[model samples]
Target: MPTLQDVAREAGVSKMTVSNVLNGRRDRVSPATIARVMEVVTRLGYVPNASARSLSARRSNIVALAFPSRDAGGVTPMTNPHDSLFLSEVEAQVTQAGLYLMAHSVNSVESTAHSLRSWNVDGAIFLGTRADEVAALHTAYDAPMVFVDNHGTSPHISNVGIEDRLGGQLAGRRLIEAGHRRIGFVGPRFDEPGVVRERHAGFVQALTEAGLSLRPEHVVHCDAGFDHAVAAARRVLAAPQRPTAVFATADIIAAGLLKGFVRAGCPVPDQMSIIGFDDLEVARHVSPEITTLHQDIPGKARAAVEVLLTQLAHWPAARSERRVLGVSLVERESVAPPPAS
Candidate 1:
């Protein structure tokens, strides 16, 4: 087994000189020295150790995709179709670019911070973490970072996210034009900052323009899960004045709501119209199909990697920027004019 020291000894040069030549630091070694080192390396069949190379360069050549612990029982962050789609695309891109990919789920902000500190990764891509928590991460780590769908108002953070507010407006406008004044919104609470908050605001904005305000009872603040959404939907439909249409913040919740509506004997679009965000596959798989605000999941994934790579290319000169992906409504069978009152 030939080591870098053996190559350097055979070439009658210093170990650092051999390292410089192997690493293509031509400026650090003369052309003649580089040629000599190459000849020795070839004659000796010397292969540089990847880990040693990375350590010398002060890099791990590793990128971590981190997810905040959503609950006590940690689940794969890809549980959300949007995250799953992003991971599928980003994993290939990261591997093809000659980097190792690590997916980590951390329960608390402190634990998340600790993981980054322990792993000597080149950079990170945070998946759907809260803006405040992300900001805390930024303050704690000096590593380059790219955040996916971080909606926090910060000029110093680099991120890729959809136009959630606009998507919300599109969904609301679509239902409004269909004569749905009694529209209800279903999802997690709007007080928390993130995509949901932005979408919720946009929906409310559109409704306000048409002299329609969402009544307190019409809003269903349920956890973003199947069973919880179904229970909430049943409760909504059971109300004395049920909404003719409902806009779910996520397709998963929308799917559950659809099941609840069916169990209650409601005919989709004919008796109750539905719209959802993310345009996940389940939206189409459902019986009537869901009309949704569609954003490019793969595009978001690629753009985040590109942003991180751009920062890595220019080490010591981090660029604080943001890229906003566009979104539009994809009209499908789930939405129609509300039935007569």
Candidate 2:
């Protein structure tokens, strides 16, 4: 590969002048000079060094994607679709800006904080991590970051997420419309800020409006991975007074619920109506399908990247800078009115 020096020598211009032309910094150089530098660069097949360019601009040009884990290690299968969707969009947007993305998984505070600092990441986007965790990172590294599918108590952090509360409310209202008076919820019970809390809040809001409540025994809490979800679903479904309808907070848990129900010979919608969040592709492909709240993964990813890039540019953004994308209820074949006594 031809270097900037080689191009500069060929164009009879200083390396800085050649650089300004390649990186679109053309204010200092005249149009004729820029045209000359570009012609030489093309003739020499020269590509600018990204690291040097980023150093000159005092930016890393490298962002991170963090997935907070629990006891279960590795990427959660339930989260794969959501992750892939956002990553694909993130990668495309970052590439357009001449930047790159670094992906990491964090299961604890110590590891997450360590990775962020050690990696020297310019900025980060938390993928479905807790708001509190992301907030902690903000305090520790003081690095620019964007949160997706999470929230926090502080006003400083920028978060891009679907209206999880609205999603929950939609699911609850859908179940109510389907005549399910006795309802249940399945998800993590963490007090930290996150999608679970938002969706659950919405669930409670809608249930309250419908003169119903999520019975204590009916609400299931599991760790943030697969095995735990499967186990939790079994216990919840095995209860004597099982809920007529169950709203799983994550699509993965919902998938496990579907499998468990199948193994127990429990017909879906016929025995117990089901609803879930995230609108993962499997949510629609599964047998009987699933009624869910549609969250636009690509939109959230694009917004988060834009926020980080805006902050990277050191521009004045709106206060709080929070963005809550819209959500809509996806009606499918899974839900129905509870069986008459």
TM of each candidate vs. truth: 0.86, 0.82
Q: In candidate 2, what are the lDDT values of residues 18-57, reduced to their tens digit?
A: 7666554445788788778878876887866767766676
Whole-model alpha-carbon lDDT for candidate 2: 0.78
Number of clashes recorded per candidate: 0, 0
- The true-versus-predicted C-alpha distance at residue 182 of model 2, in Å, is 0.6
Go through the candidates in order and give each one's C-alpha lDDT.
0.84, 0.78
Report model 1's TM-score to 2 decimal places.
0.86
lDDT of each residue in 135-194, candidate 1, tens digit only: 788777888898988888888889999999999999999999999989999988756689
Backbone clashes in model 1, listed as residue pairs: none
CA shift of 23, model 2, Å: 6.3
Tell me the deviation in Å of residue 161 in model 1: 0.1
